[model samples]
Target: MDGTKALYYGAVALVILIGISVVLSVISAIIGLATAVISGIVTLAVLVGIGYVAYKAGSWLLGDDDSASLDSIGTGSSSTSVDAGSSRQDRLRKQYVEGQISEAEFERRIGDELETEEIDDIDRELERER
Candidate 1:
């Protein structure tokens, strides 16, 4: 009876040890996978940053007028890309708020936009009269 009890206890301990080992193995695999994923993401971001910098440098060196950066790559005209009417005002306002343009620059650009709109209305009226 004593030998039988000792054997039973030894079997239970062995099973528990195997269970713990399996759990640790699974945890190690998960940690390794997470590390690999993070490394890949960081590498991708760095590559993109370098590419963008190179593109900007090349454009500057070549004296290219297309200053969209990453905004509208193949779009020729800057004005049309931003849409027409009030949306134009909204874009200017957004730029100003984002510190891309100074207060004076914002005021000047907005004034120019308003003038252009008024001139367009006048042109349409004159054409209608004709």
Candidate 2:
């Protein structure tokens, strides 16, 4: 009777071990499949991005005779020069209005900007044009 009981227990343990191994194998396979699918999607996105850049480059190089497009290709800055001091002053004014900066700090920054040479040159140029 003891021998039969031992055999039954051993068989149950073996069955449990086999079940656990099967479950683990299935989980590992699912993870592998998911990783492969995600990798494929990421690779496809990168290829599409590269293809778009190449297409744009080829179009720019081989497709146009238009002067307007060529003029815009590498020249991105505004034709008219802007006064950095005035822009900074405007930003400071906005910040003061928004209560982001103190009045004294805003006033000091505006004073500093007024003393800059670029602003002086811009003012002179404007006066000359006028």
Candidate 3:
């Protein structure tokens, strides 16, 4: 009789566990749906904000005023691309000239900078993909 009672109790416990699982699953699904909806709404709001800012900037730039000097707004200087090695050398030269660092220390730092790897394999792979 005790064996039969234990079997009945085990069956009840399994049913209870299944019911709890189903309820928790439903709650989790609701939460997940809510999160997705909230994120989408937030993304849409950010995109709209960006579009509004761009529109305002375009209108402002297109407005004609006789006294507005484009040269005053920008220095209009182009930039040159320098490699890592040359950039390090340039910094060393500047420091030495500025008297902030000694020649010997600048030489040591330049050697260390040039000898180290600036871009690893992963960075190279990403650059290649681009």
Candidate 4:
């Protein structure tokens, strides 16, 4: 599924298609069939060699993680954790919203509970500011 494997597979498929096309073309040719077959075979062999080289190059560029976990992480399957300070802040906010604490007191206490971890851009911390 990664670029390396994709390139390798694509090269292989291209070689196969080209080989088939050359064979068919040779069979339909009006000239010497033997010469055509030889030419076709040589072309096919060269294509296969090129495909192998391309496959090796791709593997060198992309590394050897067949699972491609790094690629998948960006697609929303990764897990994230909230630090203790943030969790405490969430609890405080809930209590403040429910009238368990005054607005002024909530502001002071929440402000004192400094965040200990980096905030992700997707996490709307400004909502907590309100």
Instruction: Put down candidate 4 lDDT per residue, 1-130, tens digits, no spaces.
Output: 7999999999999999999999988876746777788999999999999998999788778875444654454423223334455678999999999999999999988767653333443454553345
Task: Write the residue-wise lDDT of candidate 2 on 18-69 in tens digits.
Answer: 9999999999999999999999999999999999899878878896545556
Which number leads on TM-score? 1
- Those runs of model 1 whose alpha carbons end farther than 4 Å from true positions after fitting are 67-130
Give the TM-scores of the predictions, in the order they appear. 0.51, 0.47, 0.47, 0.27
Model 2 poorest 10 in a row by lDDT: 74-83
What are the lDDT figures for the candidates, one per model? 0.83, 0.78, 0.73, 0.73
TM-score of candidate 3 against the unseen true structure: 0.47
Residue-level lDDT tens digits of model 3 in 25-118: 9999999999999999999999999998888787688973333444344321111122545776888899999999998998898877755534
Query: lDDT order of candidates, best first?
Result: 1, 2, 3, 4
Better of 1 and 4 by lDDT: 1
Q: List candidate 4 stretches off by more than 4 Å.
A: 1-82, 115-130
Which ten residues in a row are the worst by lDDT in model 4? 73-82
| lDDT of candidate 1 over 35-103, digit per residue (tens) | 999999999999999999999898888876365543355333434534586798999999999999999
